[model samples]
Target: MHNPSSTQVKIVTADPSAIGLFGLAIVTLVASSQKLGLTDGLSLVIPWAIFLGAFAQLFACIHDAKHNNTFGMTAFGAYAFFWFATATSWMVKMGVFGSELAGAVDGKQLGFAFAGYLVFTLFMTIGAMETHKVLFFIFVLIDLLFIGLTFDAFGAPEAFHKLAAFAELGIALLSLYGCGAAVLNTHFGKVFLPVGRPFGIFKARS
Candidate 1:
């Protein structure tokens, strides 16, 4: 007679940053086109915002959580919800919810919301500095985007909105690069694309 024993194996998870960055890239690219006056309608932008911006990042957030990456989880989750909220806001603005809801809209509330996200992105920018150059620049552009968005929300100037439009475009470009780097580097098992090293500013000495 023999006794049976069972063994446990840990499952490996793939990095979610590539897909997340791709989502960010597509949505921002589309939305920035509208803000830059290259597009005429939010109707065309809504689906991408909901699917690529909100859903994709939200999916990355779940995987990041599984990987025990606190920063990644928080960043992806926050931006995912931000996109969701923005899509809903656009719907309200377009009177999709109802005329009464659209009529009751308070633009200042958007100001407050953008201001809050600006604050959130600032801290996240610091964290991104530790990741890689591509990601760092992406977050830096994100910070600028939020800054411009915040000011524009509060009626600062058209310049601020323009700044946000450009910054958002920058984010889309950088995110696409990041997505490529993540995929190619992992697939090749080498630094096929240089993302640069993390800054030594914050780590403690050994």
Candidate 2:
């Protein structure tokens, strides 16, 4: 008689947050430039929106799923899709899909979408509180950005547009810092950059 022996194998994966943040940083930086009137036209912005914003975050989302990180996966996935949809909307407005579709464009429809994202981001901002101060503030900026976008879409004053532009620029700067922290901290095997500790308010029971 022989006794059976079992061996367990665990797969290790790198954290995808750095790349995800990098993607977010790049896209927001470029988009904010346009929103701030520093740049013109969506022609160049669409490619970056699709490639960096959509695909890169989507790549992070997949790896985060493999890591069983629900928060990272959901956050990256939702933002990835948001970029994808935004890109498509830009294309449609640009008449890439044909004149008829572009002619039917309604700013109010986009307003509704922005409003919905605002609602989604509010909950996500709450969730980010347990992550880190850097991430929490990033979410806060994103919330402000969406608020401005939602109001601007609905024909709000120019101030709201400026609000969105500045908020988006803030997001870009913070995300760049977060990306650097994620990479350097991991590479150095130490806290090379401090992202601040989580608030510890809503931690799940072990």
Candidate 3:
């Protein structure tokens, strides 16, 4: 009989960070289109937010969790929920849920949401700095987007709205970079760009 102890198995998987970076790209592009009025917010924005932003990231989060990649899991999961909430909010605003609920979701409620995302973005920015160039740019743009979003939510002047559009555009561009990096890394099996150690609770498990 063959000795089981003498045999060994090793499984290799793609990088979770790469998957996350790519998802952000698609999410930002669609979000920017909505912000820029290039597409109808109701018809297009809702679907992209739910499908690409929410579902895609959620899928990445599962993989990250399996890898015992705390950084990848939390980062992807939090953003995944963010998109889900954003989609729900949009639906509420559009009266898809009900007129009464739509009326309840006023500017102040949106302001609070913006505030929450601002904090979330800031924390993620720090993590991005530790991740890689593609992710770092995305995080930076996300921080900018939150700033513009918060301002608009607070009933800022029309100028701030314009600023928000620009920020969203920036997000779109950064996301493209992230997407490119993900595809390349997944296929190449090599880190074209070096992303250093994880920050905070981001630890690799054995």
Candidate 4:
């Protein structure tokens, strides 16, 4: 039997969350190390930002879209672009785009970008409550990260930078755990690692 109405009804794809979370973990871990004064220079960080932070998440977002995972797709896609944009901004600041353009860059503008992401992450955090504890924790840390980044960009106290650094580190740790959970759970054909249940606060209204 052939159906012209649709090419294929069943769409199969591996869960992309593991790789997505791994990419996020790698980027944040490296970035936080710099912010924590344990490392220096973003020249080394740029490649990770582009490959792991941007490309890996973008790949996850694409597969997520194929799976019809609206929330996952949008979240991964947004953050994927966020990494790409931030990487480009770093290049500009480093004078890769010429001295004049680099000189014209403003830190406050990055504050605006961070603030916008804070708002976006807030709503997504609510959605994550229904996903799993690991993901929910990740969102919470993301909220904190955005908060710190926004305030730090706007010239807030050094404490804000510290806050962001710690938050980013937390994101990395939780994301690594999430990545492992996603992989092991699916591969073992059982819950090898538990992510915990949803909050159930938003169960469908009957």
Candidate 5:
């Protein structure tokens, strides 16, 4: 009698960073427009915040987790939740969750939140140094963005708000470039766009 044998199958998934960057690009573009006074209200920004900012990055986080990419998972996951919370906060402030919640709003609380994210981004910026120049600069811009946001929330001068607006716009443009590099490089199986080499400061263990 012949015995039956079991076989295991391995699955491969595509890189998720492209989608995550694309999401970041779109949301920041929309939000930065509002910050720069090119747009009117949070009412329009909220939808893109929830859908593209939250959901798209969350999707990337999950897939990165599957790939055992701790860095990608953490970065995408954190930002995804950030957008989710931001969208909800906007809704509450807009009276979508009743006037009681909206009445309790405080700008300083947002300052504290931005401060915390600034710390987070600082360390992440260090990590990005080993990634690639494009990503490293993106993290640097994010650092500037959070710094400006924190100061602006705490009633700093108008210059900080302008700083935040310009930084956010920079992030949007760079992220779009990064997204394009991720996709085109993979699809064409060649370096379609140069993202620059990673800094050789930290080497992987053998």
Candidate 6:
């Protein structure tokens, strides 16, 4: 019989949130490319949804699971599933699935979806803030993304589309930063963030 205390468990010292950050970055950049007409909308959006949104977040969730980080795991895993579902929804809308339900899901229905996502994002954002600065930035970007998505869903018109694009760009930039920070900190095996600085304001109270 193996003694659990004596068993050498290799702790995962690296932050998994980097995956989500980088994933959001890629998603936003590709979305911007589509909005700018640099690429066909469907062509770029599909890859963004699948690779960036789905797989990237899924990778983070897997790492969190390995670390036994319930909060991180739940946050990343839920979003990963959300991305997968939304990706399928996009494919269905593009007529790839041949489902009549896709046709019936207009902008308003999509708006409701965004609203639901925004609620989820809030919960995840709270969790993110408890993690680190890199994660905190990602949460902020997620909040912006949800806001933009909700607005677009409600038929806010073309100007709001630009706002969404900019928000996405912000998400990408912050994601890249978060990714860099995670990689650097992991390699160094040191606490790089300043001591006594709480990622969440509420956490400082405790």
lDDT against the true structure, each candidate: 0.93, 0.96, 0.74, 0.95, 0.96, 0.73
After superposition of all CA atoms, the RMSD between model 2 and the true structure is 1.7
* Residue-by-residue lDDT tens digits, candidate 2, 137-197: 9999999999999999999999999999999999999999999999999999999999988
Tens-digit per-residue lDDT, 1-206, candidate 6: 98666667676455777777688678777876776567775755877778887788889888888888888777767777777777787787877877686677687777887788889878877876666666666667767777777888798877766666777777777777767767767777775643233455667634
Which segments of model 2 are wrong by more than 4 Å?
A: 1-6, 204-206
Candidate 1 at residue 172, lDDT?
Answer: 99
- lDDT score of model 1? 0.93
Instruction: For residues 1-206, write the lDDT of model 1, one tens digit per residue.
Output: 89899999998999999999999999999999999999999998999999999999999999999999999999999999999999999999999999999999988898889889888988888888788878889999998998888888888979999999999999999999999999999999999989988785787322
C-alpha RMSD (angstroms) for model 3: 4.3
User: With candidate 6 superimposed using the best TM-score fit, by how many Å does residue 49's alpha carbon deviate from the native?
Assistant: 1.7
Query: Residue 203 in candidate 4 has what lDDT?
Result: 74
**For model 5, what is the alpha-carbon lDDT of residue 133?**
89
User: Which residue pairs collide, candidate 5?
Assistant: none
**Candidate 2 lDDT score at position 3:** 96
Q: In candidate 1, what residue range of length 10 has the lowest lDDT sum?
A: 197-206
* Worst 10-residue lDDT window, candidate 3: 197-206
Q: Candidate 6's error at 28, in angstroms?
A: 2.1
Inter-residue clash pairs, candidate 4: none
Report the poorest 10 consecutive residues by lDDT, candidate 5. Answer: 197-206
- Predicted candidate 3 versus true structure: per-residue lDDT over 86-152, tens digit per residue: 8888888889988899888777777788888889878878777666655776677777777788888
- Residue 155 lDDT, candidate 1, scale 0-100: 84
Give the CA lDDT, 0 to 100, for residue 37 in model 2: 95
